[model samples]
Target: MESVKIQNRDMAWHIAANIQFPPNFDAAMTWATIIAVHPFGSCKEQTSGNVYGKALAEQGFVVIAYDASFQGESGGEPRWIEDPTQRVEDISHVIDYAVTLPYVDADRIGVIGICGGGGYVLNATLTEKRIKAVVAITPVNIGRLFREGFSNYDPLGALAAMAAQRTKEARGGELQVNELLPASPGAAKVAGLTERDVFEATDYYKTPRGQQPGGWTRMLFSHAQNTLGWDAFAFAEILMTQPMMVVIGQKVGAFGAYRDGMEIYGRSTASKDRQLVSLEDWSHYDLYDKPEPVDLALEKLAPFFKKHLNEATGQ
Candidate 1:
């Protein structure tokens, strides 16, 4: 794997990324490319690069896993903000950088988005025509998630609090942030959290199993300002014309990825071809780093990208 820096053209931010190559990779010959987008509050080094990026590269494709602007090593101010617009644009910026590499087959470029990254990548496909294929694993639409709080909690009240907090920040107060989960499963259980999504996510993000500085699983509270009014699949039926594969775990909980995946798969009426792969045993968090679940997702992803991208490039 090679460390690389991609420039987010619109914001002039330097996005940190890890580019992985197949064993005995040849720079003289162009190869299909894939950009892996990490989950919200997670960095490139987590499942994005360490899992999907490396796995995809070993399958004979060049994969680039990047930290979203403002979250990881990427350059941006007011750090930890999850601006959907900037996140969506980051995909194109990475593509722009990918095409400049000699060994990358720009025409055969594809993308895989994990968790919230899945939603961003799906949204990116609407305008970024260069993307030929997509894979959304346990996808979450932040907009919807924010608008409808977990398990029927009132979003209006939450949004109102955010507005009040922003007003305080505007008055020179410290910026407030939102932590997605407890520090550990033990902590979650003690807090009376019974949802599988809650404990599992805490285990994954807050523990050494997947913990890293960049994937701390926290975001600025005002992020809901952008997310509440946005919808990742807003116009996907019309503009999302690429081949897509939506993978989801059968365990549907408060996290809502299963619902999001099902909704997008149904709404993407314009996709040239789309497939929904559901795993019976795996929960949403299981797909993050678990070997069996990851392998299950890759089983569909590898051939999907290989077929669509190679077909598009006639390679």
Candidate 2:
């Protein structure tokens, strides 16, 4: 239940991480580093990253759950901005801090990313060998999620918005948006009354269980520029080289997305260590903090880390 604030290199931003360590853990005996990424608009603590980090901490790993830049307590201007490149660098910086900690086993580091954070982890894993394992819960391929269902790779709309927002700030500033539609504009809106993309997001952010007021913000116009295919499907070739564990709940309709990854894993001539696990009657958000899937995922995952720690350490 300890937390620390860290400043990243490149003057990117200062990130606040909530860390948890196992009772009487030693740096030399089975130490682990976990980096949990939150969904695009959510902060580190308000989402599943912290929830699962706590669970893994109980199992003996040192979990570091952090807010992505420009969102949450992390520093960045034009709040709620999305930049795939900067966030990936942010991941590297977090890993940098983890390695320097006496209690963290630099060689056995892993990452846990929930929702959109899942996509960032994938991007980092493909490029950053420092990442040994990945546990993506109820994940969203941020890039594909913003592909507007692949309507097109067009970027003009997004660029224009960024310009407009910058101009407005230069002239005068005000809160742009309080919340965005849960589903993309192209996403099939749920059949019902007042709500964003889904009832759960609206309920989650508006209610105490998932709500963290003053920490949420609206999307930057076409913010998709940073996410739309933000190296999503493109990274599969590289991802096949790492050990990846995907946890998908039956609801949230993400098995297909899970399969998307499994198919890639299947093609991987490099990594046969990949695994796909499903929880019955469980939806995407169920794994966030709910009992069933969270317990189920960790039951299987903690052991995976235990066995993989050796490979991570080359022992």
Candidate 3:
């Protein structure tokens, strides 16, 4: 594993990334590479990204996981803002860096994304044909989440809140921030969050389990403005030509995300192949780091990438 800095075009920002090479890697050998995109409000070292990156590397794939722009170690101003367009572009920028590596096979690149990162992966693959395959675990469509509540309830209220926040931002008001997870376990219960959603996130991101100094639970309210009109599934029918896989927890409480995944799969007419795997016992966050669900997801991902990215035979 090596830590490297990649500069985006125009040199406006530097992306801090960790590239993991398989054991006994040789510079002269061309190897398939996988770029892992972290979830919302999380960094390269976040539990899910770290776990998946290492696991995929051990499976003989060179994997690179990096913090998105404006968050974690990546360079940007107005920290913690989650702009959908920039996030999608970040994946391509990472690919831009990966293709330059001596050992990377530029023709055989794949991508994996968890949580909100998954949706961005789908969006990026719409136009980035260099990505041969894509895997999304417990994906969330931020645009749909902004337009419709997590559970698709009280959409009017959600829209009104986003409008109010946008108006305030236009007036040069102080940036409002909101927590991605409950501040305390009790707060989750008060907000009607499921037990799995509450404890899993708090334990992984806010406690000693997998916490990192740069990991944050807060994001700028202005993110809603960018996500409000962005649909990750847009152009799926015509542009998502790569092989795609979606691994979702059946019991994921955020129904809007699950619905969005289904829509993406349904509309992806250009995919060479498409798959949707539902883990009956898993929840949204469980696939983030839990051994059982993560292992199960990897079971599917390893073969999917191997089949699609292997250069021996065109997939």
Best by TM-score: 1
Q: After superposition, how far is residue 234 of candidate 3 from its true place, in Å?
A: 0.7
Per-structure clash totals for the candidates: 0, 5, 0
Kindly list the per-residue Cα lDDT of model 2 for residues 1-315, writing each as its tens digit: 677888756665688788888877765665777887776677777664557877788887788888777777888876677777777778898898888788777888888777667767766777788888876766666666555443334445555665687677667876455355443322424545233225555555655767675347466553335554365446465555778887776554422345444543454446547777877777665666777677898888888776776564664
Could you estimate the TM-score for every candidate? 0.96, 0.83, 0.90
Model 3, 47-126: lDDT tens per residue? 54579999999998999999988888888877888889999988889999898888899999999998789999999999
lDDT of 2: 0.67
The alpha-carbon lDDT assigned to residue 167 of candidate 1 equals: 89
57 in model 2: Cα distance from truth in Å? 0.3
Query: Which residue pairs of candidate 3 clash?
Result: none
Name the 10 consecutive residues with the lowest summed lDDT in model 1.
149-158
lDDT of each: 0.88, 0.67, 0.83
Sequence-dependent TM-score of model 1: 0.96
Candidate 3 ranges with C-alpha deviation above 4 Å = 150-173, 190-192, 195-199, 312-315
- Between candidates 1 and 3, the lDDT winner: 1
Q: Candidate 2 at residue 262, lDDT?
A: 51
The TM-score between candidate 3 and the true structure equals: 0.90
lDDT preference between candidates 2 and 3, better one: 3
